[model samples]
Target: MSQSSQFKAMEDYFQSLLNEGAPEPSRAEPAPQVPVPAVVAKPTLEKPRQAELEQLLAKVPVTKPTVAAPVQAAKPAVPRTPAAPPPVVWQNIQTEREFQALFFSVAGITFGVPLTELGGIHQLGKLNTLFGKPAWFAGVMTQREQQLNVVDTGRWIMPEQDATPDYQYLIMLGDSAWGLACHELMGTEWLSRDQIKWRDKAGKRPWLAGMVKDKMCALLHVRELLTLLKQGVNIDGV
Candidate 1:
């Protein structure tokens, strides 16, 4: 069928029969559409929470840095020697009999006393000073129940020499109550008669037996020493 004839037929059918001749309505034209512009939305930005961030950081445990201590070196120990006991050698000095003599020093001067004649040796203890005594008379000290007179040996032996000496030991004379104050007590040694330069006669210094050649010190005559002490005379019995 022709396109225009088909439309005219559909239109003839829709026409009213009562209408003798109806005029064709004029076709209205459609309006054109205008294009809309594109819309771009801006990004939304949020601010940082100062209080919430601090709370999270505070919840975490904080660890402090550790420090090591410095090491130190140790020192070595030193050795010390103890003082020895006084020596005891028994036997009196005889003409043909061998003897042991104790050598001691006072104010740097050495003197030897026979072991037999030496009553006892004691460390210097507290002294009981007495007045009116000689300048050489140091003082008196007591041991056990006996009283002993301590002679300032240095002052007695060398009256002209003036000075004070620290006496360490008191050397007893025979069985007398007198002891010579000396500084250092050199141990005893064996000595023969010939080894000693014997005195054929009594000399000015009667307390001094003789000079010991090898020792180069005075050998004490305990008997005379006790006599001089008892007499309250000086070393030369002056």
Candidate 2:
């Protein structure tokens, strides 16, 4: 034995190094325990495309914004009054040279006067006032037997008679013997200097002298009021 075969080859290399460090022999059925997945925390969706664009803008149809009704101003129309101008008749009579006058009225205006300057009409007796005489005389009145003097043809042409004028008739002026008085005796009227409208001077009553066109009267000039009642002249001072 050569040392017992060299110790039997060193005990077969130490039993092959203890079979390569000894931990590789498991039977393969003990490897099934892998369950570790519990982390769930994903619930926060406020802008899911802005909540689907506000649910497609709440299905489309909302248009309310109209307030227009306040405009009222139209009311002003009423004005009418004018109607009166028609009374002046004497249509076209072509002149010749006629005469005869008289036509009277006084406070409501309308006067004529030439019956060749008259000299007789009488019947208006009692009127005695007479102090200094000239307020258009208006005093003495004995008529036909003469004393006449009277005058007052509306106080010798408007000396104020706001209604208190009765006057029945006296007239008679011719030779400055005066008398006159009168109110409403509208009697005679024949006219024609083409029915007068003379006035070249005497403007504001020097006894007028023109305008008789078919009875509108105002012709009076009785010879300039008989030379201003023979110059005792009051020229209408009142």
Candidate 3:
């Protein structure tokens, strides 16, 4: 064979192999499977059982039963009523005899009075002049539905000293009233009847009840003061 013809046949064979290898691949077919149906089972019913009957029969003839008599109940006892308590007796309460005393300051001199007879201490009120009276009997004033005869105690006790019109206070006795014009009301204190010490010899004046401690305290006789006021007597008398 000639070298060129052999080369041409080899080239033709190679071209046929390339054309067949370049072609598109075909898809594979799926396998077919047979379908199976689901199985269904039917329910079974059971029959009911029968119950047996029992019979009761006596071999001998039956007789009626005898009943016993009923019993009587016991009687209840009567209850007695309770007695009432005794009445309570109450005793009367007795009060102690209490006395109040006052301290008055006038011109540096100090004096005190038993407040038992003293009605009250108050500020100077409007004065009502009383004629035919001493200078010491300043005037009159109405207080608590009673006539209060105003007396300048400072001037009456110490005539040497003059009375300052601004200084004044009321001294109220049991059912009797008087004004003790003083420089100041120095408050009050509580004292017992035993606190008083009587003088060895009675004083010339009955108005002085007694003395207390070192103080020359004079218990202004309330009854005497009221009596003197009623009689329109000069209280300035010793």
Candidate 4:
């Protein structure tokens, strides 16, 4: 069939249906919209209440930053002063019977004589000149009811001192009448035998036995002096 014809038929068919009073097609109803539940927002906190809460929180005590105290170094202890040293004590010891000696000077030369060798020490009381004697002999002095023949020790050692005759002491020679005129009598002193320098042989003067280093004096040998006296070297200037 031709397209115009087919359209005419359909139009006639619809017209017939209208004439026949055909029921109109029912339209489907749209489904009812579901009601959405509204979201209820919580109320915002008030500014004043927030401020009060902040003030209460501020009132609470907070721990402050603690700074450790500086450590102090201990001071050094002061050292005590040492005590003074003990005083020195000198000891005098001797094994043998020999002991201290006495010293005197003549012509500025010191001479030491053993204390055991001395008979006595006397004062130069009224020195009476004896004739027919050498210039070395000073004079005579009476001591202890005995005549002591005093020799000028200074002049004997040094002939230059003969004119002045400066005699002060009469040192007796071992219970003999012979005595030495000394200007001074020095005190006694303890000396060890090792301190003296011994002589091997007799020198020009037998009386000088050794040298005493302690007092820088010549040590007199009493034995040699007695031997020389026995030889009558200076007896009456013979």
Candidate 5:
């Protein structure tokens, strides 16, 4: 009806339309519905399988530090056997009671006598030849104020034996001297008492004691040998 009333009515109607266009107090749309999935439990392992895994771990070998052994030295070899010694040879000289017979070779014949009976062996020195004596009597020589008579035993023993001018030595038997012209002096050998095998004395001459071992060896009584020389019977020849 009037202008004011019309304006008021129009305002009222716009207000009512705005209020109707506005959503009514929105109930919060329930949050979009989300479903939570249930958790699935894992299966437990067997005791045997766990034990086998532990055994495999134990079986795995571990490395260790090593030590070296000491070395030994070689020994030298020894000799198995020893050498032997040589043998000994001895002389047959036994007793002092038995005399040693020294031999000399004269004109290829050997003659020996006991060294105990020998006075001495001397080198031929200055001698005096006596006249009117037997050819077997070599000469008379002077030595130490003693008159020495020499006899050539070889010539005396065998009348056919020749005289050797190179007589160099004079062998003195007791107080008498005899020329023993020998080629060489043989070595001495011991003659035991048992070695002298004596023969019958009754059949023997005064110059010989007895036969010794088949030969007529004079039992040289030095005095008697000299006596036979003085008599010129050629003691060696007799």
Candidate 6:
């Protein structure tokens, strides 16, 4: 039998045994029982009047002090890129004549610097960071007893990403302490004037000279770049 069935049978046997052994009532009648006493009700309290309540309230302070909410600071204004591509400023850069240019990469983007505008190159050294400076600044590195201000190239060129790319070498701008941090040196190559898409008028990027046709890289206008860098502006002029 199942456990439940066995339990039911045991229960039935016990009930039968209890019924057989149960006591019987006597035929003679017993004395009558006394009646229960009545219970007393509690007295109800009267509610206070409006005037009495007002008087009680007046005893307490009239006003409770409140705390003011904290205010958030407004962010600084940022410069915007043009909706349309800007015209180039270097009109004579792209011709049949060839000029040697140094090619390099930062993050993933490539940029070419003209040999005539090239200053010097240095492997990354110990950088001394400062306080209360712009985000595009990559600290300063001293090489050969000369201090060079390093630019976080990726952040300066593409601020939206706000990237910190691994820098291997510093490409110094002509005769300036300002150097751009880059990952790789793609070496120098002679490029004809027609090999680059020169900008006739500087648009949003005042630093860009032209787009190298073969490498699909940016060509830097060193003179304009130095001016922008001296003013502490990024490629977007901010």
TM-score of each: 0.59, 0.25, 0.49, 0.54, 0.48, 0.59
Please identify which of the two predictions, 3 or 4, would achieve the higher lDDT against the true structure: 4
Pairs of residues clashing in candidate 6: 87-201, 88-199, 88-200, 88-201, 89-199, 94-193, 95-193
What is each predicted model's overall lDDT from 0 to 1? 0.82, 0.71, 0.63, 0.72, 0.62, 0.84
Candidate 6: tens digits of C-alpha lDDT, residues 116-212: 8889999998889988767888898989889899998889887777758578999999888999999999999998888888887867776788899
User: What are the per-residue Cα lDDT tens digits for candidate 3 across 18-108?
Assistant: 8895756556675567667667666533332211111123334577797878887877967867778775332211113557778777666
lDDT of 6: 0.84
Better of 4 and 5 by lDDT: 4
Higher-lDDT candidate among 1 and 3? 1
What TM-score quantifies how close candidate 1 is to the native fold? 0.59
Q: Which stretches of candidate 4 lie over 4 Å from their true place?
A: 1-98, 229-238
Per-residue accuracy of model 1 over 1-238 as CA lDDT, tens digit each = 9999999988887766645577766587755777787786775444357667777899999999988787777677677787797763322335446888999999888999988888999999999989999888888998997899999988787777664568899999988899999999889999888788877566577677877889889998888778788888888676
lDDT of 5: 0.62
* Tens digit per residue, CA lDDT, model 2, 96-120: 4888787867556777777877777
Q: List the residue pairs that clash in candidate 2.
A: none
- Which runs of model 5 end up more than 4 angstroms from their true locations? 1-97, 177-181, 202-206, 209-221, 236-238
Worst 10 residues of 5 by lDDT: 87-96
Summarize candidate 4's per-residue lDDT along 32-105 as a digit string, tens digits. Answer: 99999899899987999989999999999999999999999999999999999996432222224446888886
> RMSD to the native, candidate 4?
26.1
Candidate achieving higher lDDT, 1 or 5: 1
Candidate 6 weakest ten by summed lDDT: 87-96
